[model samples]
Structures are given as structure tokens and as C-alpha cells.
Target chain A: MSAIERQFYHFAFDPASRVVRMALGEKKLDVTEIAVKYWAPTDELLKLNPSGLLPVLVENYEDGQTVVVCENRAILEHLEELPLSPRLWPVPMQERAEARRLVGWFERKFDYEVNALLLYEKMEKRLMGHGAPDINNLRAGRESLRDHLSYFESLLETRNWLAGRSMSYADFVCAAHLSVIDYFDEMNWQKYPHLKTWYMVIKSRPCFRPLLNDILPGVTAAAHYKELDF
Target chain B: MSAIERQFYHFAFDPASRVVRMALGEKKLDVTEIAVKYWAPTDELLKLNPSGLLPVLVENYEDGQTVVVCENRAILEHLEELPLSPRLWPVPMQERAEARRLVGWFERKFDYEVNALLLYEKMEKRLMGHGAPDINNLRAGRESLRDHLSYFESLLETRNWLAGRSMSYADFVCAAHLSVIDYFDEMNWQKYPHLKTWYMVIKSRPCFRPLLNDILPGVTAAAHYKELDF
Candidate 1:
């Protein structure tokens, strides 16, 4: 069979984009990655995904069929359906549901409470030249992050992975969100030891390596952002 | 085999809850519905779902095991997995991905741009006794809803259903969101003929019967809310 051509449209600091990126990496799929400026998305990007969301995957199969998938969860599920080895989803139905649940938790609730606030304030507005970050929003986001991180710490104390025993999409989704936040150097890993350790394990994964190298203009990641042993 | 007892915790006007409710009806599953006051979620609600979001589905299976599933997508998938008739998802993998993509689109994008704004300003604040509606937010939500409705109209013009041939979760999710907005008598259906017709078809379904009867306290639905020909 002839090789399929794949293209991934994404943004650097976007946690959702990172989720698709890590999932692709886990599947060992070689594809071209193009970064989009989310603030001023190009017409081409808008045409590709009318939603104007990041992490759009375009696949051209050998059978002359082309498919374009948007939305992070949709892309992740699509990749999981492929006959590739080292499946990112767990085996059992219940465990798989738990993995999807945690993925949804990080993608929706945590994002609404934390990531959206920080990214809009610290990242998007700056890119769009809106204004300086709002102190109130940043404060609220930071507070929520602490609470979520503490919960993650508790989860890690009992389980080897976030969803269960295996390193499923849940782990990748959480790590992707945390890594983006870590780019702002706001995470106080000292307070949450178990969560920190769990993050360290994910950070060391080969699939997560490319994300560490992502550098946005004029922004520096945390001191230990790229270090696995930190 | 003994019958499986199921309880669904939901809010009357929550779109996500409506999605699950409609899915349950389509599958012909009998489940007890419990209304949740989202503004002041009880401790038991928190324990069932720490995210404090609904609708939460608690299943008492024939095996005498109890399971609690939260998040609309998770609950819908769980119900779909059961050995029941009338599948909500399509059979082919590609079609299924498209179904999920549209479901995610309605849940995230539509929710963010339209439902979140309108509900928070008009519904949630009043329910929580927080304050009156914000004109700016309501205006923004109306504008976004128009744009989204136009898109839906275009989709319905080409396809038999939102996602594909047979009615799927996408139709239920979009219909659910629209039903919530329609509760306020805000939709201008005459402008988008195709979308209105599509909604009318869904409204006439036996699965959509329960949703039509939903009446929020002190909020009178539009005159045509429960009318099949509306």
C-alpha cells in the first residue's frame, strides 16, 4: 500500500493542539505540522475549519480519498481508530470511558476554569495586541489551577496513571494543558509532589519531546520546562 | 434477567442534559429523571461528579453493580454501548467520526459563542439570584446564534440529517441546544427555513417528546414550543 499524506494545522501554545500532536506522536505517524496564528487566523485556516479552531488534521489516504478532521477530541478519536500499534486508549470499555472522561475534564472544565483564562490573558490578547493581562482573571485562574493540581496530586497518589494503570489519552491531554501553563512559569510544582512526579514521567516520554521545543515569540518557558529529571 | 435501574440527574434547560435525555429516548431506555439546581449543587452532586456539571447518569445494572457516569459525551457513549436498539452513532468509522465532530462542535463552539452567553446572562444568573441579564452579552449571543443557525441551515439543505443519512447524536446535540434557546422564544425561524424544518422533524420524534414538555419555573416557553408543526 502506498503511504498516506497527512498535514496537521496547529498552534504552539494551544493545549488542544498539543493533545493532537502528542496523540499523533504516540501513533508514530509522520506528518507535516503547520502553525497558525490563532489571534489573526488566515483565511486559509478559516476555510479549513470554519470553527477557526486549532489542531485540524487532514489525511489523504492511498485510496484517493481525502479526509479533514477538526476539533481536538475528534482528531484524537480518529487517530485512535487507526490500525496502528501502541494504542493510546485502554483495552476495557470501562477504562476507556474513564480515559475519555478525564480527557473531557481537562479539555472542558479545567480549560474553562484555568487554561482559557491564562491563555486569553497572558497569550492571546498579547498576540492580538489587546492590552496587558488582567490581574483579576490571572488571579482567579491561578487559584483554580492550584485546586486542580491538588486534585491531580491526589489522583496520582493512588494510581500509576491519571485514568488508570496505562498512560492513555487522559495523561497526554492533562500534560498538554499543564505544559502550556508551564510555559508561563506559573506552576508551583513544589506544593504538589505526586502530580509533579506524574508530570515528570509524561514529560520524559518520546511522544512529548517535540512539544518541549515549541517556542513562541518573546516568551520563555519555566526554568525546568525541558528537563526530564527536574 | 432483572431490569436495570437507571437515574439521570439533570437540569431542565441544560443542553447537555437534553442531549443525554434525547439519546436515552432514542435508545428506548427507561430512566428516572432528577432535576439538579446547578447554581447550588448539593454535596452529593459534587461527590457524584466533582466537576459539578450535569447531567450525571447512575446505572444500577442487572449484575447489581452501580456505576456513575458524568459529562454528556461519556454518558451518551455509555448508553450507546449498551445492547439496545436504534444506535445513535453511525456504523462506518468515517461517518462516526463526522458524527462526533459535529457533536463536539455543538457542545464546545456553539456552547461557547451562543448558549454560554445567553444562558449565563438570561437563565443562570436569574436562577442563582445573582442579578438581571446583561444586554451586551445577550446581544452578542443573539448575533452568534444567527450565524450558527445560518450554518445549520446550509448543512440541512445538503444532507438528510446534520451529520449524515440517519439521525445521530449530532442532530440530538444541536436540537438540544436550540431547544434551550427556544425556551426563551428568541429564535427567528422564518429566516432560516431549512434549519427550522429540520428542527421541526426532530421535534416531532418520539425521542424528543420529553424535551418538549420541559418548562422552567417562571419562564414560559414560546407558543409553538411543544407544537410538532412549529
Candidate 2:
């Protein structure tokens, strides 16, 4: 059988892709990164993902057929099953459920509020010429982000990681979304001290280097983007 | 050991809870259903779930402590692990990932477009004392629902069930949301023949009977709600 080819198709600046990229880096998987222009939705990418979303990992297993895994949470779950990575999910069923819940929370709630707001309001307008930025929507999003950050602050008060004591997929998912908003200087780090501390630990990890180096054409990282202590 | 005690706190009219209730029924687990007043936004429920979301399952898993499983998808995953129920998730990693993706798509995308729009425009105004319903948002939501229904029709074109050949958690999730909209006579069954057929099969299942019997005090089921053929 020919060697299996693993490829991930995503925009470099995408928050979802950053999470998957971090997971792949942690796994030390040699996968080719195919840059997708998310602004201009391509039929090929849409064919791979019916939702026309990003962070799709095409895994060429030994059987020659490629398995297309879309959705950041789904892709992370798929990667967790492989032996290459140190187990990112907890073994206990209850603990694993908690971890998965947080991952979904980040993807569905936080990403929808923060990343969608920042990207659509700030980035997409420049990238795609979609429309004038809606300040009201952005304000609502920022308020939602503060509410979410407060919730995370409370969670981090007791547990070391977002889900629990150990670093799991939840941390990466949260970090990925937050990093994108951080690029736009959207999050107020001081308001969420515990979240800030937890984020600092994850952000300082070796696997996070690729994400820190990510620079979009028009967007610049926050002043404290590379700082270990903000 | 005392019998495992499970309590599910949610509004009977909520689609997310309906899915969890069906899953619980399938497992033959007795859970005391506590109806949450969605309009009031009680502190007790919010304390249990900081997100203030419905369908929070508190499981007393034979151990002294109880596990709070939030998120409809996570609750379904927890139920799938219990020894009582037949497997809803496939054993293979790839199949499981596929099931998870479909569940996410339905709960997030389809629910946002179809259920949320229908509920907010038609039902929530009556419940929340919100201002006159926004016609434009409703129109956009209906258009999006048509696109979403077509996707489901296409899925049913090939497979017996939403996720695949077998009835999985995805079916319960979709059926739960659809049943809620069906309550309001929002779904035009004739428009998508394939989806209607699929819905009928799911609606007929014994686990779905409780949902059918559920009657919100002030709200009435659509004229065709009880008609199996409709």
C-alpha cells in the first residue's frame, strides 16, 4: 500500500483551523496544509464540507479512500482516536463527556459570539466586501463575549483547565477562538484574571507557536499577543 | 445501592429537552421531568446551568455524587454510554464521527434556521411579551429553513435514517426539533416529501409518545399534530 497522505484545508487565519492545527502539531502528524480562501467560497471546499465551513481534515487511511472530517469539534474527536497524540480526551466516560461539552460550548457559543462577530464585522468586510460593519451587532457580540469570559473565569477558578484538571480538547478549542478575537484586540484580559491566567499557560505551550506566528494580510495581532504575561 | 436517580430540568415545550427525554425513555431510565418556566428565567435552573440553557440532565450514577450533563449533544452521548440502552452511536470511529457531525449540524444550523425562527417569531412573542415579531427576520429564517429542509431531503434520498441506515442519536435530535416546529404547524410537510416520510417514522416510535402527549398549558398543538398521516 502506498503511504497515507494526510492534508488539512483551511484559511491560515481561521480560528477553527488554528485549533485543528494545534491538535495536529500536538500529535506530531505530518499533514500538508492547503490554504483555503474562505472569503471566496470554493466549490471544491464546499463539496468536501456541505456547510461550506473551514478546518476540514482529509485523512487518507491505508485503504486509499480519503475521509473528510469537517467541524472543528468533530476533527478533534477524530484525531483523539488516533494513537499519535497523547490522549487529549479523558478516559473516564463522565470526564470525557464534560470535556466534549466544553469543546462544543466553545465552538457553538463562544465562536458564534466572538469569532463570528470579530471576523464578520472586522475581517470579512475587508476580505470579501460583504457590507458595512454593524456596530450594534459587534457591541452585542462583545457583551456576549464578556458574559462568556465571566463564565470561564468562574470555571477556571476551580479547575486548572476549562473542562477539568488536565489539558484537553476544550482548552485548544477555547484558545483557538480567543486567539482570533485577541488578534483584533477584542477581549479585555484584565476583566477575566483566571481566564487570562489559564489562557497564558495554554498560549505559552510549544504547540501554540504556529498559531502565534499566524498573521493575516490586514489584521494585526494584539499588543500582548506574544507576551507570556499580559 | 439506591436506584440511580436522574432529574431533567427543562421546559416540556423545548426541543432540546424533548430529545433528551426520548433518549432517556429509550434507555428505560426514569427521570423526574421538572418543567422550567422559560419566560421567568429562574435562578435555580440558572445555578444548575450557568449557561441558562434547557435540558440539563443531573445524573446520580450509582455513586454518591451527581453529574450535571449540559448541552443536548453531551446529554445524548452520556445516555449512549449507559448499559441499559442499545447503542445509538456506531462502534467504529469514523461512523461515530459522522453521527456527531450530523447531530451538531442539526442542533446548531438547522435549529437556528428552522426551530429558532419559528419559535421566536410565532411562540416567543406570546411567551416573553416581546414587541411585534420582526417580519424580515422571519422571512430570512423561512428561506433558510427551505434550504435546510432540502438538505435533509437529499440526505433521506440515500439513507434510511438521518445519520445513516440505522436510527442513531442524530434522528432523535432532528425529530425533537422538528416535532417542536410541527407543534406550531410551521413545517410544510408537502413541500419536502422525503423529510415528511422520515419524520413520520420517527414520530411513530414509542419513545416519541411522551412528547406528543406533552401539552404546554397556554399553547395548543397544531390541528394536524395528532394525525399520524399528516
Residue-pair clashes per candidate, as listed? 0, 0
Winner by DockQ:
1
Model 2 alpha-carbon miss at residue B228, Å: 3.1
Give the winner by lDDT. Answer: 1
True-structure Cα RMSD, model 2: 2.9
Q: Model 1 RMSD to the real structure?
A: 2.2
How well is each residue in B14-113 modelled by candidate 1, as lDDT tens digits? 8998999898888887898888887778888888888888888887767776677888988877677778778888876556777888898887789889
What TM-score, over all chains together, does every model reach?
0.94, 0.90
**Lowest lDDT block of 10, candidate 2 chain B:** B90-99
True contacts kept of 1: 0.42
Number of the predicted model whose TM-score against the real structure is largest: 1
Chain A TM-scores of each predicted structure, in the order given, are: 0.96, 0.91
Candidates 1 onward: DockQ, in order: 0.52, 0.41
List iRMS (one decimal) for every candidate: 2.0, 2.2
